[model samples]
Target: MRDAGESPLLVAADTFRAAAIEQLETWASRLDIPIVSGRPDGDPAAVVFDAINAANARGNSTVIADTAGRLHTKGHLMDELGKIVRVTGRAREGAPDEVLLVLDGTAGQNAIQQARQFTKDANVTGLVITKLDGTAKGGAVFAIVHELGLPVKYLGVGEKADDLVPMDARAFVDALLPRAA
Candidate 1:
């Protein structure tokens, strides 16, 4: 976003994990970006609502909310995600233009199943495959796109903020293919 000249506010809405907010704050401080966060144990939806308002008040054109991660099988957690989506829409018409689900590159077929549930519950529009720099080859990327029909929006290759690179289908495919001996 810094490269694109977009002012984005990072909202730490992952109230379930105290470390999550601290992690986000650390990143925000490092990137010199503004952040809006509520109590550690507060409702995630309320945090999102306030974040949207903060963005408008602070002239931030974009709001990136880091919500709590949940297992697909957790019905209540899934419902919370749905509530966050609705709250976002209510705060701003046509809000949450894109909901991206971040999946672990090493998760294999499980990631695809998670994507299905997340798409259904949170209306996920794209995927962000993380831990791609690990031993896992991220083969599930193909399965996810092919099965779920959702585009891979980004890839987290490393721990650095800049390690999150934008997805390129051609480049990804080329990298996946074995080199001629």
Candidate 2:
């Protein structure tokens, strides 16, 4: 984002998970980006709402919130995601321009099922498949795009921030199915 001349404010809203806030704080510090965080076990929605306000006040162009990892089977968690979206709208109309759901590349068919629920509940506009550097060939990537019809916006190839690269459909397909010699 810096290279693009856009300022981003990271929100540590994954309060339910241990060290989630610290992890984001470390990233924010390393990237020299600003961040807003709530107290441990506090409301994730509130954290995001505050982050938006902070970003506006600080002249940040975007607010990227890392919400708690949730399962489709958990109704309450899904409800919480909806609440966050509603609160975000209340914070600023048409805010959260994009909601990207990050999925585990190694999850295989299970990733599709999770994407379905996330898209329905959070209105996910795109997907980010992580851990592609592992043994997982990301065979499920096609299934996810076919099943959810949402674009795969990015791929997480490694641990560094730079590892998250924009998706190249042809390249990704080529990697999944290399041509015979």
Whose lDDT is greatest here?
Answer: 2
Top model by TM-score, which number?
2
lDDT for model 1 comes to 0.90
Q: Note each model's CA RMSD in angstroms.
A: 1.1, 0.9
Clashing pairs in 2: none
The TM-score values for the models, in the order shown, are: 0.96, 0.97
Q: Where does the lowest 10-residue lDDT sum fall in candidate 1?
A: 170-179
For 16-78, candidate 2 gives per-residue lDDT tens digits of: 999999999999998999889887999999999988988888899999999999998999999
Off by over 4 Å in 1: none
Candidate 2 weakest lDDT stretch, 10 residues? 139-148
lDDT of each: 0.90, 0.91
What C-alpha lDDT, on a 0 to 100 scale, does residue 118 get in candidate 1?
Answer: 96
Candidate 1, TM-score vs. the true structure?
0.96
